[model samples]
Target: MKVNWFRRQHPLQNGDQLRCHALAKSPIPAHCLELFQKSYPAPNSPLSELKCVVLDFETSGLDPKQDEILSVGMVDIHYPVMSLASAQHYYVQSEQVIHSKTAVINHIVPETLIGGISRHQLIERLVVSLSGKVVIAHGAEIEKHFLRHLLQLDASLPLPLIFLDTLRLERSLMKYRGVMYPDLRLTHVRQQKGLPPYLAHNAFADVVATGELFLALVEEICADKPPLLGPLVLRSL
Candidate 1:
């Protein structure tokens, strides 16, 4: 689960893609298999030609191994454009008690989560939505870790994911600009980018903020020429 964030990674080569393709024939759920059957974008594909989902997760804690996800929110984005109509948010029901400190931050209480959907249902819907799309997140590690743990795909199987992380990209840009230290928090970055702030902590609001920040960053990253998916991709899971 420890991934290198200092440098951008390239898209997976054909061998990894072939492994994922082979996994599609394994005894997995139909929804996941459907996603696997869809081809990942070619490495040289233009950024605008790719489909992406901006996602955020609210959890009991940072450790996916020990923590439980409380809610998930996502919006579809095609480079500079984000689709509000495609936004989806879901609260997850769990056996864990919601601590007061965590509740204060995420604004979710035990009573609220009581009406949330089961994790299995949430993941199923998510898998269907994620078919053939990359995922965008401010800090992608949290989402990637939680998702991998939830899917419980065999460790031997290639995850076959490309997670584009705004936080990491922003940090790299700052470093290139000679700034030794920078604030990469979601709301702070949005503010720096002149994006209007939304109420924080809510999963849906955070996803929207991340989506906007992503578009702004893309504008900066591709200012000279249209970039390919390989460069914009920050990490693969």
Candidate 2:
């Protein structure tokens, strides 16, 4: 009963089924349709067979409605193998001024974005990269929220997507051990797991940090071999 209620509160996707149903609806964007056309992995698929895109975004502020994205970093993990050679980083041009506090946190300023790409262009590249692959993020809600808003999709129809949320997976493990209020922050969690610290708050470095942490968590959870995909991925919305 508890698990059922919790799942209701935080919904999980049925992957391809959801995609088929959503695709049947009218007024979906071409990019979104293009994304959904690719089949997601079956629930029984091994994690080792999955191609995961670990991504991070530095935003001007937390509110997706009001604030803007400053930069994005992403790296591909052909599960159980990660290579820095696949990493891509892009600073985003925004009309808003970079506040001092935001700059202090992410070290990105207006000057840094002078040569940056437009938000639409970045999303186009991101959509192409994300096709048929699962997304992994430290705190995936930030990315999910930002992407949904940027895509201008109707809030009524959520994206038919699955995210491997490192933050949620960590919290789920801690809860199973009866530990509440665990330090689930990206840096703290990495430290606790003995992951070597990377330069904090920079988008590229942070994506690398997130990807490493995901690998560590998966190893800890399934030591014998790769686990099935169903138990690990979730729908953030």
Candidate 3:
């Protein structure tokens, strides 16, 4: 899941309208289909208690107008237990050409994505999947900007449910000592905390990695104060 972060791209212009049209495509990959089938909520779990969805996205390049989203990945965190059963991932067909550096890393060649779903379908599915859950991304700015672009594109589309940044949480945990790096990249935090290794460039892998880091940071924060997901997210602001 090696991804080339250096070649990432943005998905919209500053004032572009978000639009959608149905486009047919081949069935989702068998593995993805299986994962989606098993990724539903537990029968008795209250939707209100779902809390947040750990999200990560890989894009074609960094400029919204010139770039496109290559894939989006998320994990619905309900607390107490974490597993692949709660994960979701989607590969999209981008109109933008995949940059050479990006292709080498994510391995998402243009030909391989020939029959993938359109941006509209992908965004609709993402919004539906994330309907009531907060979104937690490694670098909040990138995800936030992307979401804002989506809103500008489609004024009718609702803004994100709620948002949090694991990057900020990690920074707060080390406030006294100062961060070793000016930018708190997810890989750096994972390494410093001795959490699981990051599968760079893979959307789902990054989501899982960030989720683990978030849990660890919550534990550390809880040691000095009570733990509540909402408060932790707020403390970062």
Candidate 4:
């Protein structure tokens, strides 16, 4: 029989809060979802022991207040290992539409960009995927701000997320070693560490790069066996 690597071993999670998929469209207050906290690994758990969801977003613009989250891409991580079995990509439905300038970077053509799910629906799906996992991203603050801003707009979009940022980690390591550069783009950073080049812009691909970069960083930080995850967390900016 084949194995389902990403399958949730515990179909009945202990004290798991209401399933995001089962919830109605109506908004739920943050306090109401407190019991579901355990769905994700504890903030202090070992990085190698926690399951993570690598995340990347392509937006209509850079500013969260003005720009829209054009797309979201993610892949699940089994602790220190990466897996593509559970990868996902979704383009958000919007009235603003994709601009030519941004399109050049994200490679989401006009035709393929059509037919998107509502933000609420996307959040529902994201919540279900992320309920019990850590989040990995190149620059986590971007995703965090955008998601939090969306949550503020729609309370039902609640997700308690902890992020592992590859770019930030690399920069810190470089700085500690007294290195500096003009740019620290994802592909650039990955190449600096001898990782093979990959096409940029696509959210899924970016997440994959970020995931791989994270593993490489862990190899450096942990050496053989790193301590608990609490110490590695990057504080909210």
Model 2, 1-237: lDDT tens per residue? 744654453233344555666677656887667776777777668878888899889999999999999999999998888889999999999999899999999999889999999987987988887877888999898998988888777765656667888998899888889998999999999999988878999999998999999889888877786687777864222
lDDT of 3 by residue, 1-237 (tens): 112432241111111111111012223323223222222233233323666788887877665556777888888776534566879888888777778898988878888678777777776777666655657788777776675564343343324235568888877767746655555788888888898676788998999998888777777766755455445545555
Lowest-scoring 10 consecutive residues by lDDT in candidate 3? Answer: 14-23
The best-first sequence of candidates by TM-score reads: 2, 1, 4, 3
Model 4 ranges off by over 4 Å: 1-36, 39-44, 153-159, 180-182, 234-237
TM-scores, all models, native as reference: 0.88, 0.91, 0.71, 0.78
Report the lDDT of model 4 for residue 65: 88
In order, candidate lDDTs are 0.80, 0.83, 0.64, 0.70
For residues 56-123, what per-residue lDDT tens digits would candidate 4 score against the true structure?
A: 98898888888888788999988667888889989888777678998888877657658977888777
Which structure is stronger by lDDT: 2 or 3?
Answer: 2
Q: What is the lDDT of residue 171 in candidate 1?
A: 87
Task: Name the lDDT value of residue 51 in candidate 3.
Answer: 63
State residue 124's C-alpha deviation in candidate 1, in Å: 0.8
lDDT of 2 at 105: 94
Tens-digit lDDT string for candidate 1 (142-185): 88788877877666555556778999889878888998999989
Off by over 4 Å in 3: 1-50, 153-158, 180-183, 224-226
Single out the weakest 10-residue window by summed lDDT for candidate 4. Answer: 9-18
Of candidates 2 and 1, the better by TM-score: 2
